[model samples]
Target: MSDPAKEYKQLKEDFVSNLTGGSIGEINLVTAIVPVSVLLWSVLQKRHSFFKPYTVNAFGLDYLINVGTVLLSFTLYSSQPLLLNALLIVPALAFYLTPPDSPTSRKKPDVPPKAKSKHGATATPDALGALPLKPFLTTYRGSMIVATCIAILAVDFRLFPRRFAKVETWGTSLMDLGVGSFVFSAGIVAARPVLKERAAGAPASPLAPRLVRSLRHSLSLLVLGVIRTLSIKGLDYAEHVSEYGVHWNFFFTLGLLPPFVAAFQSALAIVPSYAALAVVLAGLYEAALDKTELGAFVLTAPRTDLLSMNKEGIFSFFGYLAIFLAGQGAGMYMLPRNISPRPGTTKGAQRKTLLLTMAAWSAAWAALYFFATSYDYGLGLSVSRRLANLPYVLWVAAFNTAQILACCIIDTVFFPESYKAVDVSAEEEAHRGATSRLLRSFNRNGLALFLLANLLTGAVNMTVATLDAAPILATGILVGYTFVLCSVAIVLDELDISIKL
Candidate 1:
């Protein structure tokens, strides 16, 4: 055999080359830097003490650090760890920059003796007790949606490092997690409220209303995706499949499943239902592949119309449903209970509680990950987006949880004003700074940006040769693309012209 040391050296060289050569992980890091920097600066402005005067410098420093972090993350460690840490660090840095007298600035005078409920009555209840959790959840979902769009743009422009783009053999690239977690978070956000309503004996929206609007929305997007492909890339269905990996809104199918799975609400019911369904489908798919005549055909088939629609596309609906249900289960745990308002939790205590919760859950998921990957039942659990297998679901949940935990830490520590419902008024929201505006804009017009990115991707490919771009040039193009998208979306948001499905 060849020298082992030599082989490892070659592999290390290849890894470095791939990372610097526009890897997806690197691109994702790059794309995430701006939004995250904006968020950090927004928090700094909200602090309104030492930071208010240094706002410009803080923004510049945050952006510079973000850019440098991208290099360090991919070079020192992998993207995932660096990203999770970077997200968590933003709030801590904001906290550090917070002036000693900042809280005193916002502190209200002691309540009048006549108005006091008790001698020591307080205006705001503790955030740890029961903070308004919906805003946090909404922010997480919206942020993920925008981030997902950015990641996709980075990938489409041939900015993703070619080394990390090996979807077939790669067990789970950072890119895969980005896509998978986006879908999972989407499912959680979309169904969490509705499912909670059903559980609480609240009347369900009629199935026709529930699915039709969402179905139409997804269909419109699908149509737009297709038209953009045709107009920009030419009318090549086969190539579309090759490029985007099966042309259909996985979200559409996710939207369609909730009505059917409405009866399965509790973990006792939903978890087992998903488990049984996943097991049966996995068995059937495997058996069909191993033993049936159709298996041979599928194995040998090219990207024909039949294969695309049946095996590659629609067949995965079942697996996608499993992933969605898994997200619903996660949502149930993370999201606040849908109940009447009560005394809200204190921001400080809530932050501690959430940090503990996140740590415990991370550990739990890590164990699950170990079991799913190591202890195989003859049927292996692979991370197939098409199959949405057990290991895949667990891994997605694990990492998504960690990422959200990081985000929660950031929100609670730096921007505690947004921790509760009452703090978010139309006037207050309207007057928010550019960073928050950008986030909310992207959140509100998320699907629009997604579609826009698709069109833009096609347009860029048509005009420019993106494949052989240097890393710096590719990053510059990404910055410009993001600026344009954000500017348009921000204006629309300012005008309250959200293009909702």
Candidate 2:
């Protein structure tokens, strides 16, 4: 008879193997529920005072409505996502239909008094105009984190549908998108420093100093990657070697990205833009995969030496780098060019910026559609998260661009006052509502949350027979796990603690 432990390991391996993923439309819709739910809950708090306590400071109630409900929709209701989506939509529709003269509407808007220098001259637009962008990014990023944390453990159980798991070699799935999205999100945020550096007008710092700074930034991630590798090996944990290869993990991929980008800073400067550079990189990489033997080697080569052993991780780094650069380009468009607006910055200028940003993303989406469908004329490539190929890069870029655009639209529709040019104090007050507290919490301690989730996943897997657990029990375990993560995040936020790296 086979050893039970060995048998269980094989069972787990078979579970995540050979997945082709579901339709993109469905995945997009299911993902859309996260932001929509945030919008709905926010509206409920504003339109109906009764929801304020429950949706705001109360932990249990807030978790159930915001985090828990999303968890359920992604897991239990995953197969029937449309029905779940409609459920969120109905309440939002009702809130919109409510009378305009309601008590909540009667309250005076919190417009801030204009700022004046001691000399009584009008001050330039305060940094507050940038505040509206924060929640949108926070919500987008927080939702991605929550989904990833849940999916990692949930995929081990029968309760979670297989379609949402990472695909074997090709095609799109929720989890596949998560990896790219994480890279893309990091890239978007990293753009700020690049913009700041350019705005400084100083000569580019010496290469050694820049490289040192880049290495310093990557040190924590590299340390985490090492710890994860040693722990997994020491524990003899079940792993899908094909995912990152025999030893390489996602953490290593993330850790190495910064130094690699730094090394290429000069090359990137010569390119018209990061996005253009990304296109060139992805095109060249895809050609290597298609026109040469690289693709065959990655798929079929024997694992031997250090390079061969971690082929997937090494080769895929360039693709992920492209994704990150593309994200930086997107950030340049979305984020303000300077820390402070120019002296004569006007509302019309802000409006123009917003419109151009929307138009740029819309064009990206349109391009994605053309390439994704036109097999004969376009790139005509299947998306391979494994290879991080061109189609996969484009898909990740376009999908995230769409989501960012959606968040912008949601913010504009629900909180139009935020978009208006206002002083920093006034802008902060406008966006300080209870609606996005949880998301803000998640954003504050994202790295901490990710690490905790990884530790918990290992602990749970070792202690529980995840594959053998009944569906209801599996779901209960998942709910409890998610609750713990949420509670920790909330507590950290309350204490004003942000654990970086």
Candidate 3:
């Protein structure tokens, strides 16, 4: 008889590669080990190239050095965090992009236009002509993120020093270096050839420099980039949380996205009725789940001290919300011509709005905290058994929804898409895009967040839960790491790191 467990294992392999030893921590370390090495190699070998300031490729060796060391430190710790308490700060590398093959190596092949129109094999700019080079540039963050993730998965070095001593574990690092880089790059740049190019009059290449694309294009591109990064991180993070036996809830997170996005779009839709309908769907699903034992199964998985670490407890109904919300926000951020090129936008109107929103969030939190103390508001979800509690879900959703609305508004008003020019024969636009930049940025930096979040969640579970210090340390390490992560992200942004992976 065929073993169901074997079939299940095969299916898992077919879909997602896991951490070593079937352990969450092992998986994290194994996946991270290779990425760290690649980053180190890239940093150690800093060389310049044609696309200097335009892409993540520009970070060169330093990108590897900084990111590599970080990954290595995280994965190395069985229970120890080397990155922060190192008392030893390694200098971040300084370098720029360089393709595997040098520009000089290419004598410039006579690249003929592949697309030939019937009019005497001539070319036209209307999706048939040569285009100008894209002037916009996405930071190299995406490349680093994907590359590192690939590296981690490829490599399987043990975080514990004892495990590292083994020969089998050693080879995993090299395997990761070889395979991870390719996959990571592929993930970030799966969409290069067919993206839109600018018309001939546009002197600059919009596609190459993503940020320079028009507002519509920019927003769309940004959303894609964000989705890619968040989705990857979200899934990965959920898996990590699952190690906690009860906290891992990516499905719960994902279930929330589709509806959130739908509801959000309803708000932005031509017909408000559509959005209202989406909300109805969201409510109905949760209600249905609430009415059934299935809902109970999702929220109230066997609460065991030992298994609780798995993080299996979640209202699956809300899992889709994250995806929906992220997608919806992206869609709205790509505004049509209605509010384009607004004047005095950078004058801080929205920034003030953001600040005000921040204050409002703080106040709401204080009130909620106080209310929870006085009245048992079921984990901040107003007196509900499951996620279907409308008041409970909306209370949290209010903030999430508002956050997206705010981001979309800001992006539309401030970060409009810029167009690129192309030659009918040989212009330099890589492709048309903008929204992807947000995602690309997210992708590149997503790993840092993922690692840090796991560490935090792990440590928190230890302290918060009745577990040993090991898990607590893991979670706390992440908590401490998060601050550093945010700062690094900000600095990377300042340094103009690539937003698109």
RMSD of 2: 6.7
Number of the top TM-score candidate: 2
Candidate order by TM-score, decreasing, is 2, 1, 3
Tens digits of per-residue lDDT for model 1, 308-330: 54454455455455556656556
State TM-scores per candidate: 0.67, 0.87, 0.33
Q: What is the C-alpha lDDT of each candidate?
A: 0.51, 0.76, 0.35
Best candidate, lDDT: 2
Tens digit of lDDT per residue, candidate 3, span 280-303?
Answer: 554665455435444434343566
What candidate 1 gets wrong by more than 4 Å, as runs, is 1-43, 46-135, 156-159, 192-201, 205-217, 225-310, 337-361, 375-380, 420-435
Give the CA lDDT, 0 to 100, for residue 254 in model 2. Answer: 92
Q: How accurate is candidate 1 locally (lDDT)?
A: 0.51
Model 1 — TM-score against the truth?
0.67
Pairs clashing within candidate 2: none
Number of clashes recorded per candidate: 13, 0, 117
